[model samples]
Target: MNDFLIPQHVNSFHRANPVAKLLCMILLFMLTLFTHRLDFVFYQMACFLLLLLLFSGHRFWKISLIILPFLLVFIASSSTMILFGKGDTVWWKWGLIQISQESFYRGIHIGFKSVTFAMEGLLFVLTTPSVALFYALMQKAKLPPKYAYSFMASIRLLPMVWEELLIRRNALRIRGVRSLRGGMKWLGILKLYMVPLLAQGIRRAHRVAVAMETKAFDGQGERSYYYPSEYSKSDIWVILLLSAAVAAALLMSILLPPFGITDVRYR
Candidate 1:
């Protein structure tokens, strides 16, 4: 199940102009940050999922599962907070626990807002090539050259990580080595996955260090970029759109403080 939900090795999005993907991330992140309205956030998240469906793989509902556990946690936490929270409108009371209308509102608010936050983040993580994303960030954001190179060193390691995990999984099942009841439990399976993965990871880390040394990766000196990470007209358009979205959220927050627009507030 984890393997299914973890995004596939998709090279499709690579065809999109790197700049376009960057713009999309910026706009979605801006929407996430500036919008205080829960409904707007929810809508934005839905829209992002929709984008994933339309753009790369339309089978998002089948593939996307990471949203579930976090949503469950937030719903539980917020419900507990609201039930015990001190507020003016007490819905019910017991010897040790009380449920208030105010608490209910607050919890629902937090839960819905959290959905927005998580979905906002998925925009960058689920889509967009890491190398291209980092290049755009470092170049346009003016990150220090030495830091960018060091950061990129880690980003470049992901393929190695993925390959190692893939190979390990294949090797285990092939060897016919049953571990703790033929992988009857997820925990048992996780052990099979992790032990070999960790070993490979440690080995890869050492190899990476040696490779970096061979390439003379001394961050103490100046460096040159292989890709021209310069900005274009699309970047300006993206920035302006983001600014407008932020301004709109701020305006709405100030004007409509009473009639909130997000979550399960329909009771």
Candidate 2:
């Protein structure tokens, strides 16, 4: 199967611009934050998921499962709150907890609301690499270079932390300290995990400082990069395409009724 996420061949879209995607992603985050309408929110989530699926391989589905717990809780609680709470019109009530027509619709709305925001974040992280994103922000967006470097460095450190945790967890398992079920025991387990992780993090930081010093690392203003990024024709198209997509979603949102199109009548 051909990989879609990274793209085997740097197509016109991917090749010409990294900044376009960054801008689009930032726009996506802002869009999700701005809207409370479920339909518009769903449109954004749908677009995000559709894009991820197109670019990402079948493993994309697996990647999405990373947030299954959040989805499950969101759906479950939203449904419970929506169905069993009383408001404007009471469908049914159990003393303090009453199921109302308004509550039910609200619950469904809340579920989709959470899902939309989650997908926006997922899309950004899945598509953008840390270093590339940082480079774009620093050079293209003219952001602080130190901020970019720190962001990139944190991202780079993630894998090492994951590996260290995995190793420590495995060692604990081998020593019959596998299950973290008890009270203080859990804290002990956390300490066991943290000791090596913190030590390594500090060690890595010092090494990075030393390496930078050895290379005469001066965090100065206006640094130049080797692979200079320039906006191309495709970059222009990407920005245009993303703009059109967002506009369409917004247009649809305004055309639709304020509290949603149809009223629900639950029997």
Candidate 3:
């Protein structure tokens, strides 16, 4: 349980300050938003994906499995622009559907941007632990203890909630209860599962609140943390590495001739 709650470090990147890594992610997000060149976006997406594969400390197949779902995200994000966007060079046209060269380029660019965003976010989530993140925010970002501890409490409760749900499901199966298969199906599920879950959650929350009150956690006085979030030289290295990635992507975009489409906005 302790091991499940606290993730082991995969590499130096995983050990870097959570606050620093979060800030770097935000900076990368801002950079991605301003970038309009399709080639630039592609390079950025590829760079992040490569970093994810390298530092995720998983086998190639495992990483591929993790990334498989983002294919859907890419398709879903780009489809709209490709199907209906306005442009001069029409490739195909039908009733209420249009495809053009500029739209195709724009759609691909948007897809790349979306995938890059997901990759960057996944990189952070895969590397950082919830406990460490909340603690980092509290200590370094000056987040209030009340809010941080509440977030931590919610994280702790999630596994137990999942376990309870499984137990309830098993119990229902043992009792020969089957779900309804019609218009009333969703309502039946809500009544059977959601009600119990909500009731149990409320009870658990009450108990936790009382326990916290008994321990004087409500006080605003300075308190010592069991898991201290600290900054070290590795944080600087993490920042430098991410900055280098951004620079490399930009350089790649500049050196390689763009795919005949520079800015997606006017083209």
Residue-by-residue lDDT tens digits, candidate 2, 220-264: 676787556677787776667666667776676668644572323
Q: Please state the error at residue 68 of candidate 3 in Å.
A: 1.5
lDDT of 3 by residue, 1-267 (tens): 344323333786788999999999999999999889898999999899998888765566766887899999999999999998888999999998999988999998999999999999988987887788988988899887888888788888999899989988898889988876889677987788888888999999889988987886665858888789999988988888888888898898889846856799853
- The TM-score obtained by model 2 is 0.74
At residue 57, candidate 3 shows an lDDT of: 59
User: Against the hidden reference, what TM-scores do the models get?
Assistant: 0.59, 0.74, 0.90
lDDT of 1 by residue, 1-267 (tens): 134434544533433435565666666666565554564554444554554454443255653565567668677767876777767778889877888776677666666566655654554455555666566655566555545556677666777778878887778778985555544576877888888878877787678777776786544444566666665664555445445554555555556544464433334
- Full-model lDDT, candidate 3: 0.86
Order of quality (lDDT)? 3, 2, 1
The better candidate by lDDT, 2 or 3, is 3
The number of clashing residue pairs in each candidate reads 1, 2, 0
Rank the models by TM-score, top first.
Answer: 3, 2, 1
Q: Pick the candidate with the highest TM-score.
A: 3
Span of 10 residues, lowest total lDDT, candidate 1: 1-10
Superposition TM-score, candidate 3 onto the true structure: 0.90
